[model samples]
Structure formats: structure tokens, C-alpha cells
Target: PRVTAFSKQLEKFHVIIDSELAVKMLRDAPSPGKNWSAFLKVDCGNNRAGVWWKDEAGVDLAVLLQNSPNIDFAGVYVHCGNSYHTSSSEEVIQVLDDTIERLMTFVNHVRQRGVTCSTVGIGSTPTCRKPTDRMKSLTELHPGNYAFLDVQQWSLGSCTEEDIACCVATRVIGHYPRRNQMLIDCGFTGLTKQGYGEMASGYGVIRGHPNLKLCKMTQEIGFVESLEGKLDYSLFPVNSLLYILPWHSCATAAMHSVYYVVEGDTVVEEWRPTRGW
Candidate 1:
């Protein structure tokens, strides 16, 4: 909708374009009567998208975006999405700080081009936890999803375990004679696997069972493995419901068509479904 609003105003006030194709579209755009700002995207350390910041001509794309009569150069932006793929907060901080330093240098180079700049921006959840003032000099910090954090964010120091707001509820289908094992009805079908490989075991975390872990899963079968020693049969029994915390709640929740809202022991309502972009 922001893009659409800017498009409608393409003929009136100033605006900024975030994508390269957007830069080009606005660049070759017919006379809009007003100038629009478009920044080049550069990948400093993140290999995902955007121009390589290390490239000598990285900021040169900004120059191209400026070449158009209707398009003004806003500055470059990059996102360290790759930073979320780490285990420790210390490691996440290292990548975020390094990327910011590299991006600032690139922004400076754009200024050296003698073009009047408007803004510069970049983002990530782990990066958001770092002091924003250091990058406030940037045009904007557009980090989304911090509001709906998950286990990955918790482990990365972006948030605490208490910050995760989504979870899964499954019932113990069959108790294993092997002590700790259980055949849960939930499997890849219920909770899609999206955990970072950093975890010691399975794709999901068991909520209250500190010693019990989701060992593995099949189409509709789950193997509960004991954290240590042998599994005792006294604690959990067949038909006992378990709330499984996801490694990444958003991704796992996306698998289910609907979410049942359970209060205490009874589900009173169901949440609506969501669509992907």
C-alpha cells in the first residue's frame, strides 16, 4: 500500500523506491512533474540480495537512479537477513555491527558523488536489538516481525523466551513401551520444520518438559527422546496434550490452515488463516 500510495502520488510529491526494478521503472517513467528518490540496494556482508557493497561501482547504481529527471537518489539500503541464521547473540551482534559499518562507508561514498541525498536505511530482527542511535543517522530502520518474535529471535538476544507469542498443541497418541518414546499425532504435517541447525536436536522445542525432546517425526508419527538417561513412564501418559514451542513460530504456524485458541483446557475459538506475500 505504501508503494501504491507513492505510485498514485508519482505525479505530485516526492517519494522513495526500495527495489532496483522500482528504481528503473521510476527512472524511465514519463515526466511525473516532481522528483522521486530511489536508492541502490547493496549487500555488504549479506549475500542474499542487493548490489555487492564491496563492488567499486556499488554506489554507481545510485548514480543511475539519480540520472533520471523524475528520480532522485535517496541512498543505498541492505538487510542482514542472514544474521538470523546464527546461534549466539554475540555472533548476531558481530554481523549486524560489521554490516552497518560497511553500509555507512558506502553511504559516504554516495555523498562523495556530489549528489544531494535524502535518506539511507537497512534492517533485521537481530540487528534491531542493537542500539538504533548508531544508525539513526540512516534515513529509516525498516525491521518488521520484531512484534511477532520466535525462538530463533529469543536465542539471538533480539528477545526473551517470554516474547514468543505463538505455540502448538498436540496430543500424545501412543506411549512407547521403550519408556520415553511417544507416537504423537503431530508431525511435519502439523508443525513444519524451520529450526536453525544450531539446535542440538529436533525442529521444535518441548514447552514444559525440560528433559523430554522431540527426537524425530514421520508423516504422522513423532518420537520423543529423553534428554538424558532413560525415559520414565510415570510422568507422561497417552492422550496427555503437549504444547510444543516452535523454533520459528511464524513459519510453523503458516503450515496450519487455522489455529485453535485454547484457554485452560478447552478451545473456545479458532483464529483466522493468513496468506503469504
Candidate 2:
């Protein structure tokens, strides 16, 4: 419906097909605008979606989609999401290279069969960031998390702390001097329940306070714990403001409707984001 609503301005939109049935459905579906194409999603290694790379069915589906007159074959795309599972940059690059090699071989096979495959889209933040050189065959890189680097991205060596852009600003609501812990107004509702990769003890790090971490939380309250047990409790009194770097910026940002865009300490603008499907 949204596509039809804006059909006047939409020149082309490509839908990803994971199976032969999806390709058939896309081919049969009425065009929403002037040009609509289909992208065959091949699972190079991710195992998340798309037809498996070694599976002959995938090639058959691609050939079918390419020959279909109603839907143009926009080529194949693979999202190597498992790239984040690697422990180091070398491993990430290896996964990306392997994925790309498989994708290239598949495209080559399709071309050998007299099919005109043009675009080969590949992306995953860790894979894209770690690759020493770009794959010449890949037409597009669609790394989503690169825009707002999260703790996971930093842990995966995909980005650094300086590259992180989003954070949660919370105020101290309660203090536990005896346990060296304090309660902040931010919780799962605001900061989200996501945790940093391999850093099991805390959910997120407090900006500028390397030893302080948001360890636990309820619906509306976050427990700030001092990692070293040497934190001066006097500094964080009631109503004191603190900024929390989110473990996963995408999930955390989804909790808010409008972004409070700030420049230095002043609110410069308000940006509202799209919501719902």
C-alpha cells in the first residue's frame, strides 16, 4: 500500500527473493510503479535467509527470475551476518572473502548459462569494515550498523569508541553508598536490554567513566555499579546527569519516537523518525 501510495514518484524498487516461489510471486504481482525488479538472495554463508550457495535450486530459481519478462533480475545479494561471530579482524575478513568468492562463483555460473546478472550486493558491518580491499564484483555495500556504531561493533573491531554517535542521557534517582551502586532513571525502556559482546557483567559503559557500568535494570530503573569498588559516591548525587553508551544503538534508538538533536549542550533541533511497518 505504501508503495502504491507513492507510485507516482517511485521509479524502481527491487524485492529480494529467497526461494523459487517468492520469485514466481514477485513476477506475478502487479507492478506498483514504472520499473520493479527482483534480487535473488543467495545465502553465501549466513544461513539466515536466502537460498544456499551450493544448492542447485538457487541457480535454477535465479535463471527463472532472469528469464521472466514481468520481473527483471537485479542480480544477487548476500548479507554475511555471521561475520560478527569472528574473534578478530582476520577472521572477519576471511568470512567476507569466502562469502564474496562463493557469490562471485555463483554469478559466474549464471553468466556462463547466458544470464545477464549485473548487480552483486554484499554487506555486514564487520565484513565491510575489515576487508582490506573492496570486491570488484560487488555493486553495493549495505552495512546498516555502520551509521551508529555500537558496543558490539567496537567489540567486533568494526569501529572504535570515537565512531559511536548515539547515547542515553540519564539522571541519578537513587544512591546505594554501601554497595557502591546507584540507580539511574534509564532502564530497558530507554537504554534497552542489549549487552556488549563478551563483556558479560555490564549492559553498557558510562561515557568518561571507564570504571562505571550500567549492570542491571528494571523496567524504568538502571543499576549503575562501580567496577573497581573505588568510585567516590559523593560525585554522583541525586539528580546528577550521566551519559550511557548503548550496547546496541539500533535497538535503543527504536525506543524513542523523536530524537533530541543536540549541539554541544544546547538542543539544536528535533528529528522525528518513521515508526511501524
What's the TM-score of each model vs. the native? 0.74, 0.91
Candidate 1 local accuracy as lDDT? 0.72
**What's the lDDT for candidate 2?**
0.82
Per-residue lDDT over 1-277 for candidate 1, one digit per residue giving the tens place of the 0 to 100 score:
3544556665545444435577677766665455664656779877877877777666666766767666666666788887877777778777777888888887788778866666677778788776544665677776766756777777777887766767778888887775657777788777776773646547677787777778787776777877787777666778888777788776777778887776666889988775755
Model 2 lDDT per residue over 1-277, tens place = 5654565476677678788777676666666655457888889889999888888888888889878766888888999999978899989989988998899888888888888888899978888887556577688898888777888898888888888888889999987878778899998999888774446448887888887877788999999887776568788889999988788888998998888877889989987989865
User: Candidate 1: which stretches are off by over 4 Å?
Assistant: 1-39, 69-75, 85-90, 114-117, 178-180, 229-234, 258-276
What TM-score does candidate 2 get on C-alpha atoms? 0.91
List per-candidate RMSD values in Å: 4.7, 2.1
Clashing pairs in 1: none
**Candidate 2 stretches greater than 4 Å from native:** 1-9
